[model samples]
Target: MKRMFTLLALVWAGSSMGADWQVTQSDSISAYVLCHQGDCPVRTAKVFDLPVAVPMPARVSDSAAKPVTMHSSTSVRFALASARLSQTEKAKLKAFLKRHRDARRFLVVGSTDQIGKKRFNETLAYKRGMAVAVFMRANGIPNRNIKVDSRCCIEHPPSTNPDARRAVISINE
Candidate 1:
């Protein structure tokens, strides 16, 4: 009898807590933002925090956002002076693009390290961006569905976090 009453009391407490209204909850999108070489100090790492929530925004989709696809250089290095992906990095790009082959369109946006000349880095970034698109096309993805663009390196440098070297690919059906 005592044990039963204790269990009932616990259940009642749980129910009472559930009756409380929830006002605001923290939410976030998890992504790796690479720090380009020159923009952030060489060989230094910066950390940041992002939060996320369940039942994501109605306007945005990709329910499986938890496991983000990531590919990084051996060190916090750049391919040219600014771009991140190298020849070894190329294989991961192929796989990353292949994962979203069924999508109607894939956007490949490239970024750069803050070290090089702007015009050169911009062109290089575009090439890196196209490099991914080309990989997708070569692997049987339709050309129409792949879009590439490069926005130079950091317009505003992020902390020296190596994750800041990242180029991101988003797939949309």
Candidate 2:
């Protein structure tokens, strides 16, 4: 029994000395014995020390992992030429914004009909954009999160037809 116990002990020690391990990305940061060298035990190593550790390193297969996607806020489209917001539209939009205020960043774009001249359209668009942004700001939205852009006559051509100047509000999460 004593001989048997001694034999088992020797076998255990030998097997532990030859423990099979791979210097994976995790192991590269630590030290462990590798199976490649029959009798060599690797000591503590920095990631730079191992030459084989980085050769054609394992590629992260996008397909193998679950696709990571970020959620985006739905875009709100409103008619700019209209003078006023209908009651239902205002209520619904206000409620939605109230719920999403924490994560929303807004962009208000104002456009004008190509009625007078290019310069006139540009001025109108700028004012409309500013108006929309100010309106939103008045409605509990912060000024910091809002961006205003104008597309005057560039977007609207009076030659095409008579159209009202417009403003649009967009939100991003």
Candidate 3:
């Protein structure tokens, strides 16, 4: 019977020889050893080295006031001497307004081609800006947030060759 018990112990040791062991550690400084077989006795366990802690990066404050401006990719075009918005222009402006719903302020600046008289063009520009501002107000943007400006033909046109008659919407935050 003693011989049979010794043989059983030898078999168990042989089976454990091919098994694998793993150790896992976390920030809590506690570790666990996993053995493929039944709980193996832990002997002379030591941590050779520990990982160093890294400092976290600082985050930017949300309260910092920064001005952000965005312009429409395509100008809102109008027929000569008219402030009426075309169907396409209306759709484009609607899409723009929807995208910038979070904007706190907007500057609608209008311009005209150099073909018309300076004073007439200036009046036309102002009217066009007012039209856009009115549209924005109708779409739930507050009047206080809307600022109208008319450039007439003073500033360089966005497009050099084409007629400069268009409304430009600038969103500010």
What's the candidate order when arranged by decreasing TM-score? 3, 1, 2
What's each prediction's TM-score?
A: 0.47, 0.43, 0.55
Best model per lDDT? 3
Q: Cα RMSDs of all predictions?
A: 21.1, 17.3, 15.1
> lDDT per residue, candidate 3, 67-119, as tens digits?
55654433588887889998888899999888888888898888787766889
Question: 75 in model 3: Cα distance from truth in Å?
Answer: 3.0
Model 1, span 51-100: residue lDDT tens: 66578566776787676543422221244454545766667666665565
Residue pair clashes in candidate 2: 80-167
Candidate 2 lDDT by residue in tens digits, 85-154: 4555456557766766665577767677655677866877777777666666778888898888877664
Report lDDT (CA) for all predictions: 0.60, 0.61, 0.77
The C-alpha local distance difference test score for the whole of candidate 2 amounts to 0.61
Off by over 4 Å in 1: 1-87, 155-166
Residue 92's lDDT within candidate 3 is: 93
The TM-score of predicted model 2 comes to 0.43
Regions of model 3 farther than 4 Å from truth? 1-74, 154-163
Candidate 1: give its CA RMSD in angstroms. Answer: 21.1
Residue 132 in candidate 1, Cα distance off native in Å: 1.0
